[model samples]
Target: MFSPHGPSLRELAVQALSSVERGYDLLAPKFDHTPFRTPRSVLTATTEALAELGPFSKGLDVCCGTGAGMSVLRPRCPELITGVDFSAGMLAQARAAHPDATWVRADVRALPFAGHFDLAVTFGALGHFLPAERPALFAGVYRALRPGGLFAFPLGAPPPPTSVPYWAAVGFDLAMRVRNAVWRPPFVMYYRTTPLAALRDDLAAAGFTTTAPALPALGRRRDGSPRCRLVLARKPADPR
Candidate 1:
């Protein structure tokens, strides 16, 4: 599902075998050309949803690779926008693309800000975090936002077990488990690790009131359920 400019099979193989940071560094230049990039359809849908909920001041894009989510933040929050990522290569590419915004090199697990933003968005980055690590990530995001601020991201419904995509994801996760079992510097990326229930609990524990809004732009499934939902998490106005 990659474009002509996307990484080759050998390049992907090398990336899969390397550490997450190194793998992303190798993929940074062509990341936007891959299926891995957050699709424009999702971006547009999220922007529309946020428009109804916002008129925010400052926005932050957590793990903002190539700054795709920055466009969504731009319309919702006008004063300032910041994109943060631990990947130097990805941040460099993002900086070149959006010179008007600030780019900070920092890990999402330990975000380096407090009460600095009115809204935060992340795209296609959660899979890189293991289930056990989500609490810390959510906490960091919570700490970065001002009172009554939001941390939003889109999450798709899990693929059916009867589908090819389901088996593919299962196989990919199995392979990653084996790789981590045998390799140094574990590369944590699992498609099925984060579930809605667990995530809701984690967000609540981190002091956010979470809501899942149906992303109508993505349409519905055969069962009439939403294909994707945007997780809108608001940090309580008073943490005390």
Candidate 2:
């Protein structure tokens, strides 16, 4: 319903009634056409900011919906790159868009890899997991990367309570909680769940040394703080 090329309201309703994996599979064909696709500005900003920390040998895109992140990973990681996600339909789109890169189908909560990639990135996919599910996801990403490898993703600044976007997010999350409570198969997505502090704690528990550098490319909020920050979670060179 977002655009001419996007899914219709009926299609979206059908998808929502299904499981998260199934819902995404139904949406996969029109996913890129929707507002849900990671914004170009975010991708461009992330690519530029991440460039300085890289020259990485290999890269990975976690929960890679349609492989948009492969573009960010390609230049700096000259050797090879791969994308992984649970939905076969999403993988189909990603594989078609970027045939040169490997696409593996697997759930992000239990990502399957270890010590293989020097750089890994995920974009616009964090809200899929609940607070309790983050540890497994973070741990898996930690294990997927080579020691000292970097895992980066762009995180937006939360809106203040006074703002329209803040209330919108709260309403959206509350709707999701209600939907999940009543639905047969839960579609687990929430807007307000992943704040910076909670994210840092989860990453730390997963053995990542975390830093969030403000993305000036995304501009500043009304309060003059950054509109977005890139979370750079590095696996210790020595995982001891």
Candidate 3:
């Protein structure tokens, strides 16, 4: 659901018809007004989890839309913080909001940095990439980090099969499939695609040791599992 100041049905329709870059450009001004922006609660939980493993130097935020991940990166990374995304419009909003942090306009699949970051965090942006594309995305993040550096993100538990949220996600992904079938310049976002096990396997294939620690701040699901877990992937340290 969107706020009173958020994009209307007509505006959203037009955005959905455009390419991802152009769509975000159109939505950038009111993105914060919509539910699409990462919630402050989730951000806080992620920050707390990362703080335990950090005291890091340079930090990178992959697919950093509107710079929400910067809140987590700033305190933990004292030396430098950078946010990278392909959307110029999103980068512009991020620049205006956090003028001091470095904003780079680059695609995550081909991140243009090498052993440059000590810590990296991404929030609420994974659904944009399909499962097959994740290899490139994870590989790039691995390549971007310094030896033994980390790449972390908060992942939510899948809703129970009988739950309303589960059905809602199913419906949303179904609608997206239909939309992409009929439309050009498809907007790729699917809620059900990234499962925790698959993602951990992908991280391993990309040469990172991966772990998921339950975020107590977010509480638990009805099934007694943590509502959210922070996936921490660490690139191996170079052999001396």
Candidate 3 structure quality by residue, lDDT tens digits, 102-201? 9999989999999899998899889999999999999999999999899999999999999999999999999999999999989998999999999999
Stretches of candidate 2 off by over 4 Å are none
What TM-score do all the candidates reach, one by one? 0.98, 0.98, 0.98
In candidate 1, what are the lDDT values of residues 100-125, reduced to their tens digit?
99999988999999999999999988
Candidate 3: give the clashing pairs: none
The lDDT for every candidate, in the order shown, is: 0.93, 0.93, 0.93
Give the Å shift of residue 26 in candidate 1.
Answer: 1.0
> Which window of ten consecutive residues has the lowest lDDT sum in model 3?
231-240
Each candidate's clash count: 0, 0, 0
Candidate 1: which stretches are off by over 4 Å?
none
What does the lDDT come to for candidate 1? 0.93
